[model samples]
Target: MRVVSLVPSLTEAVAATAPGLLVGATAWCTHPAGLDAVRIGGTKNPDVPAITALAPDLVIANEEENREPDLTALRAAGIEVLVTEVRTLEQAFSELERVLVHACGLDRPRWLDEAGTAWWDLPAPPEASRAVVPIWRRPWMVLGRDTFAGDVLSRLGVENLYAGHADRYPRVPVDDLCAAAPDLVVLPDEPYVFTADDGPEAFPGLPSALVSGRHLTWYGPSLAEAPAVLGAALRAARP
Candidate 1:
């Protein structure tokens, strides 16, 4: 079954589970190191014509990572599009199964079970640290309200300050973020590439945890290592 994945996490999941099933993927699907699929542009703006030409049996995407218009266009071209919505870790596991097992007709991979076990076995921190997680700068958007990233951080004992905001990814002024007075700043290296020199200076005296965006955000095989990876980064910042 030929598949075109617009979501990076799902791309890694499919590529790792069943090699060569993906005929096309977004340029941002960078996991598994050396993937050899046709590039179909980025997640927000996939090249509809280029994807249609690929004639994939399935195109897997996320409701948040992908744009609605692109999914509509793909469906208009009679392409079967599997759109996933993952707001929590459990939801992520379920969605991964939906895409790989139900949609692709592949047996449930062992990594999926191991990932679940890994998270389940994690020892929760004695106290959760309130955190402000910025996904982007300039306009300053943060992980707000029911996000997969927020859930991931929560599992690692870092609570998102904007998790109750009405918008999923809300644009707030940097001043407002600083005023929130989070215990620490959790910076992921994607969507904006917040580096050690770049992001931490904004919050004086506050420990900034520079984390792997793949482990912090993506919900594929990385799930197995996220608890240890994120926990270490969080521990380093707090220590």
Candidate 2:
């Protein structure tokens, strides 16, 4: 079955499972390096006409990374679109299974099984740390309530300062974020690229952990390495 994926994580998942099945993907879908799929466009503004031209049997998308109007447009073009909403680790696994077994009609990838075992078998950290995780700068956007990344951090015993906020991704002042008295500040390198030298200075007295955005944010094969990858980074941000 021919497939086109709009989400980078999903693209990687599908490509890893069966590279030949992926005929097209978004320009942002850069994973499993040297992927030979046709570039459709960005997640927010995919080239629907170009995608429809591919005549894929299935198109994979994510609720958070993609817009509804685009998905509707794809459906309007008579393309079978599979939209996934993954807000938690469990949901991520379940959705991926659905996409692979149900949508693409392929055998489950071994990496996915390893990922589930890695996450579920992890022993919770004994000490919890309070932190401010900033996704973007300039205007400053933070992870808020009910977000997948927030849930992942919670599992590692790190409390996000704005997790109780009404907005899923809240734009807040950097000064106020510091004033919250979080023991540490966590920064990821995607959506906004925060490096070790660049991000640490903003926190002043607070220790900052510059983490891998792919591992912390994306759900796919990376989920298997997240427990160890994020754990080491968060471990350095202690009081």
Candidate 3:
């Protein structure tokens, strides 16, 4: 079945589950590379005409990625639309299972079970007891509260310093980050591409490291392989 994915994470899911089935996708959908398929548009503003012209059998999107108006329009157009909303690890796994079931018409893969096993088996990072994972720079946005990233950190036995905050993705002053002074600072490698060179000069004494944004931040089938990568990164950043 031909598919058009408007959400980046769903794009990754579809590609992983059924590769060549994707006929169109957004520019931001860059997982499972070599998907030179049609560029629908961005997350917020998909090229409706272009997508309509593709006439895909299914169009996948995310509640967080696409705007309501566009989703409404797509639904009005009578396109079979599947929307995914992933806020926690359980939600992520559910979304993955849903996508796999929809795309392949089968039961959820054993990968999910294996992923759970890997997560449960890993020894919690000692120094990561209190950590803050920064996903963006510029205005300094962070994964806050009960977000998927926060849940992943929690499962690894790491405490998210911002998990106490009310906002899910909060933009705070660098001074606030300095004040939190977490045991470890996790700088994700996308959105803002924070690297070790960026350092923690703002926090002075915190140990920091650059981590894979896709592994730590994305919520999809990729989660199956993320724990090990995150575990090693957290271990290396231990104070």
Candidate 4:
């Protein structure tokens, strides 16, 4: 079946489930390397004409990734749009399974359930008591309560320093970060690629680690591999 993916995360999911089935994708969908697919456009502004030209049997999008206007336009064109809103890790897994079911006509729940169980079985990472996870730079955005990345850090025994803050991706002041004085600071590699050099200068007194952004933040089938990978990374970084 011909499929078009407007969301980057869902593009990764589709490639994982049915690699060659993705006929079209957004320019940002670069997860599964070697996917020579058509770039229809971005999440917010998809090339409607290019997508229509592809004549895909299905188009996948995410509520957070694609704007309502874009979805409305696609729907108005009578395109079968599968919109998913993935917040928590469980929701991400569910969305991935749903995509697989729709794209490949496969029973994805069985495999997803098994993977979920395995993820739950892994031992919890050491609790750092207080921690801050930075997913973006420039303006400096952080994960807040109820977010999948926040939930993942919680599972690792790291309490979000800004969990009770009003915003999900709050712009924290450098002084505020210093005041929080977290035991650990997590620097994700995507959205913002923070290196060891970026750490010492920005956070002079904190112990920081550059982590795999996808493993810690991307809440899809990747979660199965994340718990172990993240747990090990955090453990190794501990003082």
Highest TM-score model number? 2
Predict model 3's lDDT versus the native: 0.78
User: 1-239, model 1: which lDDT tens digit per residue?
Assistant: 99999999999999989978999999999888889899999999899999999999999999889999999999999999999999899999999999999999999999999999999988867488899999999989999999999998887788899999999999988889999989999999988999999988988888999999999889999999999988889999983
Better of 1 and 4 by TM-score: 1
Q: What is candidate 4's lDDT per residue for 1-239, written digit by digit as tens? A: 88899877777776776677889999888788878799998878889989988888889888777888877877788888888877776787777877888555865744466668867786755655588888777777787767778877788777889888898889987767878888878888877888877754787767776788888767555767787788777776666
lDDT of each: 0.92, 0.91, 0.78, 0.78
Better of 1 and 3 by TM-score: 1
Q: Which 10 consecutive positions of candidate 3 have the poorest summed lDDT?
A: 119-128
Model 2 scores a C-alpha lDDT of 0.91
RMSD of candidate 1 to the true fold? 1.1
Cα-based TM-score, every candidate: 0.97, 0.98, 0.90, 0.91
Score residue 70 of candidate 3 by CA lDDT: 89
Error of 4 at 97 (Å): 1.8
Question: Which pairs clash (backbone N, Cα, C closer than 3 Å) in model 4?
Answer: none
Question: Between prediction 1 and prediction 4, which has the larger lDDT?
Answer: 1
lDDT for 180 (candidate 1): 97
| Model 2 Cα shift for residue 79 (angstroms) | 0.4
List candidate 3 stretches off by more than 4 Å.
103-107, 123-128
lDDT string for model 2 (1-239, tens) is 99999999999898889999999998888788999999999999999999999999999999999999999999999999999998999999999999999888888889999999999998967577888899988888899999899889989988898999999999989899999999888899987999987777877898888889999889988899999999998887676
Error of 3 at 82 (Å): 1.3
By lDDT rank, best first, the candidates go: 1, 2, 3, 4
